[model samples]
Each structure stands twice: as structure tokens, then as C-alpha cells.
Target: MTTAKDLLIIAIEVDPSGPVGQGDLSLALAGAELIDLLGTRAVTLTGDRVLPAGDAVPEDRLLAEAVASLDREAPYETVDDWLWRRGRDLFAAYTAVLEEDGQLTRERRRRMSFAAPRTTVAESAARRRALHRWAADEPVILALAAAVGIESEQTEEEAVVTNDAVTTVLAAVHDAVMELEAVRRRRSFENAAFANVWRGA
Candidate 1:
């Protein structure tokens, strides 16, 4: 299973309503895709920039699309740029693909007629593989998960990923998530201030 798929499955199975909101999770998933591409040598990291290292397309549709979207020119794309550009609504994209592949199922909302149906990870070999990898505390996956605020039993120091490229991508993901959170907080405060002004408080 691809690391992106495994990471998505683990996220859904663990706690869909937890600290890792869609935005944070999406950024991490984008990082996960890059990590997988690095694994296949489809791309490489030159410092913090992503350099396309191969012309072969990945077998996975999303991954192939990712490879196709690379900036092939000089200076290439920075990992930070790729994360934001590629990660826009990426969680929805991955969920739709998983549902199409029968790795995820959407449960009908019985009472809340206006609410979106709840999606759950289906019982499949894919899920089993993800769980196994999570159980083993694989450094890359663990680090990706931690980026989204999903804490594993493994401590921070113990979850060190050896590959420098992977480590760079993971750090980028964490920074992106933190930046997104900061944006969220700033907007929230602004909205609250606006509401208070309107209320003459």
C-alpha cells in the first residue's frame, strides 16, 4: 500500500473528529505522497526543494497526478510550496478515491437529513496493513501522523526517521500545519472582535 493511502486510512480509523482536522490532515497527506514518491525515486529533495528525479509515472492515479503536477523547470518547487499547492482540499480527494476503491464506506445519516453522511474506513486488507504499520511505529508514518497531532505511544526522539529527505518533508508538514492553525486562530479572533463590535460589547 502507498504511504499516502496508509496514512489516510490510519487517520480515518483513529479519530476522525479529533485534533487533526481536515486541513492539517490534508497537509500531512500531501507530505505522505511526497515521501512515497521519494521512496520510488520518482522525486528527490535538493535542500528544501523538490526535484523530479524520474519520468516514470506512479501506478496510483493520485500519485501519478502528483508526479504530473511537478514543476520541472529550474529552481523547481519548494517543499512548502508543494504542500500548500497540492494539499488544497486533498483530504476530500483521498476520501473519494478510497470510497471508489472500496477501502472506505459512507454511512447514511439516519437522523440529520441535512448533514453529510459519515465516512468510515472499511474492513479490508488496506486497513489491516495500515494498522500493522502503525503498530510497528514506522518512522515515516509515525512522523506524518505526529505532524497532524495524532500522538503515538512512541516518544518524539524514538520516532526519528533516518532518511534526510523524508525528515525534511515531515518538518515541512509540521510547519505548514502550524501555519494553518495560526491563520485559523487569527481569523477566529478577528471574527470575535467583529461580533463584539456589532453587539456594542
Candidate 2:
């Protein structure tokens, strides 16, 4: 029986050239949103629509709550171990669904390839690139929900809620990217200033 414990959470984010302090937090929030969306979709699709509507919270807050809820409900030996395992599973499921639905292309597939028995290094590089692009695109929320088995909906309410959730999450991602860019620029300016002031004799 696949319980909530079997489900995994993985945060996705836009990559900053240099690390930003908030990058991890943003990604963690994104992952939580994906988990929440997926959990909701899973229950609904399974005819077990008991989970609460996630319409009230902003995307980041929703994600935070989801993570907290998962922590309270799931038993794991260590937090890091739990996160790593969950990330791997979610990534695999997300990639597979994208491929099946034609949302993932051959070029993207090449970019997101990995070193498996039949794949070359070039393929692995391509796979990595594809995954990076997808991460940058910020489709993890919808993709993860689809992976857990959400299909085309007939109800206006479901459609509206899902669309709103996706939009909210994407907006949060854009803000995170901009924030990261600002941090990178600040670091660059400071580095240049320090270098210019210290002339080695």
C-alpha cells in the first residue's frame, strides 16, 4: 500500500550563477508546493478527495505547510536521507510523465540524459541539460501533479483552482530568480571593489 510516507517531496529552482542565500529556501518552498499539489491531485484522482483545498495559501506558504505536514506525518531516520530519497523518486516520475506526454522533446531528452547501461556521456550531458531547463522553466508543480496521475478535468472549479495554483507557484519562482540575480550582481560588485582597492606592490 502506497501511503503518504511513500510519496516524496522535491524543491525546484532557477539556478543562480553563484549561490544565493535564499536560493535553497526558494527551492525548498517550490518542492513543498509540488508535494502539496501532487498529494491533492492524487487523492482526487483516486476518489479519495479528503485532503483540504490548498487555495488559501500563497504558493510559498502552501509549500511550507506541506513540508511541515509531511514532516509530522512521515517517519524517517534522518531529514537529509528522507529528502534525498524523495527527490530522486519525484524527479524520475516527473521526467517519465513529461516524456510520455510529449512535453519533453528529443533535444531536451538528450540534455537530461544520464549514464545508464545504454546511454553515452553525451546523452547524460543532454539529460542533465534538459532537467536544468525544466527546472528553470518552473513546471515542476504541474508536472509532479501529473506524474502522480492528474488528467484533463471537466469541472470549472478544478480547472480554476489548478490554474491559480500553477500561476502562484510560477510567480514565486520568478521572484526567486530575480532575487538570486540581484545577489549575484551585488557579490560581483563587492568583489570588483575589493580587487580595485587592494593593489599588490
Candidate 3:
């Protein structure tokens, strides 16, 4: 399975204290795709900029589309730029693909009697592979998971991710997630103040 798919499965199957932000998850998924591309030598990073290495198509359909979307011009897309652009609604896209591929199944959320059923990652080979990778403390996948607030078996310093390109993408993902959180906080404060004014506080 592709890194993107594996990451998505982990996000769904793991029981975090709270739901992962769709935006943060999407950005990480985009970063995962870039890391996978680097693994295949389909693309490489010159500093933070993405440069296509060849015309080779990726085996996964989503990854193949990612290759097609690369910027081939001078001053190629920065890793940060690619994250936000390609990551737009990326979680939803991956969800659709997994569902269509039968990697996702639905079950009743037992705790909430009024709650609608939710789609959960199925018991499949893809899921087992992802969980095994998670258990093995794979640095790239763990780093991506951590960026979205999922705790890993090993801390960042202990994991010791060696590849510079993967490190670059993971750093970009962390920064983007931070920026998105800051925006959320700012909006929340603004709305709170607006509510106070409306209530003549």
C-alpha cells in the first residue's frame, strides 16, 4: 500500500482522544505522498522545491495523479505550496478511494444511541500492513502521524528520521498544521468577541 493510503488508514483506525482536524490530516497526507514519491525517485527536493525526476507513473492511482500534477517549470513548487494545494480536501478524496476499494466499512457507533453510523477502516490486509508499520516505529509514517496530534510509540528525537527529503516534507507538514491551528484560534477569538458585542457584554 502507498504511504498516503497507510496514513489515512491509521488516522481512521487509531483511537485518538479527539478527532483529527481534516485540514491537518489532509496536509499530512499530501506530505506522505511526497515522501512516497521521494522513495520511488519519482521526484526529488532541491532544498524545499519539488523537481520531477522522470516520467515514471506511480502504481497507485492517486499517486499517479500526484505525479501528473507536479510543476515542471522553473522555480518549481515549494514543499509548503504543494502541501496546501494538493492537500485541499485530500482526506476526503482518500476516504472516497478507500471506500470504493472496500478498505472502509461502516459500523454503529455504540456509545451514542442517536449518533449516525460511521465508516471505519475494515479488517483487511492494507490495514494490517499499516498497523504493522505503525508498530515498527517507521519514522516517516510516525512523523506524519505526530504532525496531526497522533502520539507515536517513539518520540521525534528517538525516531531519528535520516532522509533529508522526508525530514523536509515532515517539517513542512508541522508548520502548516501549526499555521492552520493559529488561524482556527484567531477565528474562534474573533467570533467570541463578536458574540459578546451582540449580547452587549
Candidate 4:
């Protein structure tokens, strides 16, 4: 079963322009893993929010710890809230695993005196093939695409869409775009719902 961490790594490698900073990349990766685990029934999601399922944690150390955290929550957390804050640890942990697996190598670079680790893809063809297959099969893209498209059509088909209704549409479109971007930074990640706003290519 592919975790979000794996998908993030693959996305980074596949994108020609790599991540700009470690912080953004790590959190984004963590969010991806959270979503993946949820879809696998390892956790639960209600709308965009995530709640831990009362089930045994998986054997995968990374996912197990994440699930445990969610399950142990006082009053469960939204997946974005949890991952955006704590994903750095998960990203670091998974990169070490990839380094050991010989698919990537890490090198440290100093950016304004702070050390930033750079990841180089070592096994390109194999990894790309795997990512491609995952992209084709993953449900996230479809969900996001539909959401963005529907929201845009609604807004455009009616010139006088209510302020409250427009706000709701924007929120849904933003959530979908954010998740889709985290998964695959490809051209297809865009939809007309965000035409007025800038979405990084």
C-alpha cells in the first residue's frame, strides 16, 4: 500500500522544478500521507476533516504513529491542521527510509547559513513508472477535478451567485486545489474555479 510520504517523494522527483523549501515540502508530504491512509481505511475522513478510526495501527511505523496520534486526540483534528503542523517529522523519517532504499540520495546545501537537505532521484525510470500508475489509479485527482469543475460551472453559469454561496464555492475549490497540488504538481491539477486566482503551475 502506497502511503502519502511515498507519493510526495515521487511527486518531488517527477516535477522538473523541485520544492523551494524543506518546510513546505515536509508539511505537504505529511498531508498527502494523511489523505492516503484515510482512503485505505486506516483512518477516517468526514468531508475534509479527519478522525482516527478505532482500529489496529498498521505495521508501517510511520503510518502507525500518525494513526495513533489521531486516535488519541482529545477531540479529533482536521487532517490539514494536524499534518500542516507536524508533517516535518514524518517527512524526515520517510526520507531516511528512501535513502536506505537506494532510490534517492541526500545532500546538504547552505541557504543563507541554514542547512537545507537536497534530494536527488537515483532510480528514475522505475520510480516514475510507479508514480504514473499511482496517479492514474488515485481517486484524489478525480474528486478534486470534479469539485473544481462543478464549482466553476456553478459560478459561471450564474452571474449573480450569492456572496455566501460564492464563499462556500471558493472554499471547496481551494481545498481541492491544495490537496491535488500536494499529490501531483502537474498541469491537470488546475481547474476554472481558480481562474481569478493564481495557482502555481
Candidate 5:
């Protein structure tokens, strides 16, 4: 199954300069993995946490490793931490797979280097078409939006086209995060207000 991770590989392949910069690529790629896992019903969210829905281990290397990693710290973990940790490793693995699958052409010397190599997409029209379709995918759009912090009401509202359950789960989580953020903002305002009042006194 071509996942969000695969689509991200395509996005980077087509544009070596991606939507997000090098420093944020890991987080975006990791979020792509979560999007894949969530969409496939391989995992489910529980109050902003993620847990495997079933015992079936995946055959895909990335999926297998992700499920396995959850085991080491079972009883589930925060989606934030899990995605952050997984993003770093998945970026490397997916990049290698893209080169192996002929989707990306990389300089041999660059492969041996510690940093990511300069790479380009394959010259296949069919592969490009598939990627174009995936890029338009609602989940992919959501993941990309998330990666760059591009807030869009249209994207969230459009998420129903993918999976209503996933959209609902994400919305619930979003509400919680926003609420906490609002509280923090309010507290900061109050703190500043009191400080000004004390200075005036």
C-alpha cells in the first residue's frame, strides 16, 4: 500500500526543496507515518494517544517497526512523542526505499554521507500521476498542512472525504490542544496585567 510516507517521498522527489525545510522534514515524515497507520485502521486514537487496533503485525518494514516500537513502551503513548520519535528514523528508511524502488535517483557519493543526498524523481509519467493523486488525498493534505503549520479550515472541513472517524478523532484532539493553548494565553495575559499594575503602584 502506498502510504502518506510514500507520497511524501514523491513530494520530495518532485521538489527537492519540499514544503517544509530539512529541520522539520523528520516531524512531517513521522506525522505521515501516523496518518498511514491511522487511515489503515492499524492504529486508533484514545484521548490523544495511539494504540494498535489489533494484533496483526504488518509486512511493510516501516509499519512493522512502528508497531514493534509501541510494544517496548506499551499501554500506549502520547501521539506527539510517538510521532516525534518515529519521524527521525522513518525519514531515513523511506528515503532509502525511494532510491531502491527507482522513484528517486541519488548520487552514489551522497548516499555515503551523513547528511541527506541530493535526489530527483524518476522520469515515469505513470508514477508521477499516482503521486499527483496522492498529493490531493485528504489525509495527505491534512498531514502536509500539519507539517508546515498552515492552518486551514477548508482542510479540516474537507477531512470527512477520507474517514469520518479519523476526522472526528483529530477534531477532538485539536479542540483539546486549542483549549490548553487558550488557557496558557489567558494566563500570560493575566501575568502581564498584574506585572503592569504592580509597576504602576
Candidate 6:
């Protein structure tokens, strides 16, 4: 009995688009194996990989990092004012990605609006919370085989190929999520320290 990880290694070792679609099939199988490993409901393997859900970090820290990052790029002296401006920008970018990917229709996008009262501490906190939730829950990879209408039960070789592709996507998505969380944590720490300095003054 070959393990999912073992199958993944094999799939990764071979090129997907060789003389045949062996590589592609292997990749798909890898994804299926990963889905089994990661717990299906926790993540949905939509396109090339599973969509990640759950809070990656605390709400306050997530917001502070976003504000700090935006302020560093632009110029904002106060957190209250900065939250209002950056919140809109962040919402726009988030919606744009969702729309472009067909995750949300035009009507849906129009109907949905981010309402954060301007210059209020509550508004800033809410905006940060929403952004953190989005960042944490967004799907990292879209599984390819299912998107193309490939069935799981095919041949031994085909199953192997599909598993390989999926595993590759899973590994990449996992790594990316880890990196994002790490960066978010670092930014949160920096923002906390900066906020303390502001308080001291």
C-alpha cells in the first residue's frame, strides 16, 4: 500500500506534461491523497488545491499589520484615519480577486458592501477583523483535475498521476500558507511595538 506522501514524491519527481498525461494524472491523485490527509471539510480542493479556512491570527494583530503595511507604503500619521482609507483599498483588492476568479458575481459584489464607520476605533477594529478573516479563509490553490472533469476512479497508473498533481499543489499551498502566517506574525509584532512607542509619546 503506497502512502499519499510516497505517491506525492513520485508525482513531483516526474514532469506532468511528458509524452503522455501521466504527470498530470499523478498530480491529481496527489491532491486527492492530500485532501484525505488534511480533513476534507477543513479545506476544499476547488481548483489546483484546497481552499484554506479558519483564523490564521488574532483579529487585532492582523488589523494592525495591515494598517502598518499600508502606512509604510503611503503616509498616515494616525491609526484611526489610516484604517478608514486602507480598509476601502483592502476591500477593493479583495473583491477584485474574488470577482476575477468568478468566486463572486457582479450582482453579488454590488450587493455586498464593507461598511466601517469612518474615524471610529470600532470601525478600524471591525475592518481589521474582516481582513484577517478573509486572509485566513481564502483558498490557496484551485485543484486542476476536478476543474477539468476528471474522475477519481480510473486506472492504477492514472490514479497515481492524479495523486501526484494534487500532492504537488497541496505541498505548495501548505508552504505558502506557512509563509503568509509567518509574515503576518512578524508584521503584527512590529506594529505592536510601534503602537507602544506611540502610546509612550
Better candidate by TM-score, 1 or 6: 1
| Winner of 1 and 3 under lDDT | 1
Candidate 3 regions off by >4 Å? 109-114
**Candidate 1, 37-156: lDDT as tens digits:** 999999999999999999898899999999999999988999999999999999999988999999999889878599888888999999999999999989888988988988889998
For model 5, the local distance difference test gives 0.60
* Alpha-carbon deviation at 86 in model 2, angstroms: 13
- What value does the lDDT take at residue 116 in candidate 2? 38
Candidate 6: lDDT over CA atoms? 0.35
Score residue 106 of candidate 3 by CA lDDT: 69
lDDT scores of the candidates, listed in order: 0.92, 0.37, 0.91, 0.53, 0.60, 0.35
RMSD of 6: 21.6
lDDT score, residue 21, model 1? 89
Largest TM-score belongs to which candidate? 1
Order of quality (lDDT): 1, 3, 5, 4, 2, 6
Best by lDDT: 1
Over 4 Å off, model 1? 112-115
- TM-score winner between 2 and 3, please give it: 3
Candidate 5 Cα misplacement greater than 4 A, ranges:
72-75, 107-117, 124-126, 134-139, 149-201
CA displacement after TM-score superposition, residue 128 of candidate 5 (Å): 3.2
lDDT of 4 at 59: 72
C-alpha TM-score for every candidate = 0.96, 0.33, 0.94, 0.55, 0.62, 0.27
Q: Report the alpha-carbon TM-score of model 1 versus the true structure.
A: 0.96
lDDT of 3 by residue, 1-201 (tens): 899999989988885335698899999999999999999999999999999999999889999999999999989999999999999999999989999999997677778488767878888999999999999998888888899988876877887788888889999999999999999999999999999999995
TM-score of 6: 0.27
Better of 1 and 4 by TM-score: 1
lDDT of 5 by residue, 1-201 (tens): 355455555556545564544435555555556666786788887766777786777777777777777733466677666645675555567767766867768655444568655676676763666466545655555545454444334455565446654554444334433444577689999999999999999
User: What lDDT, from 0 to 1, does candidate 3 have?
Assistant: 0.91
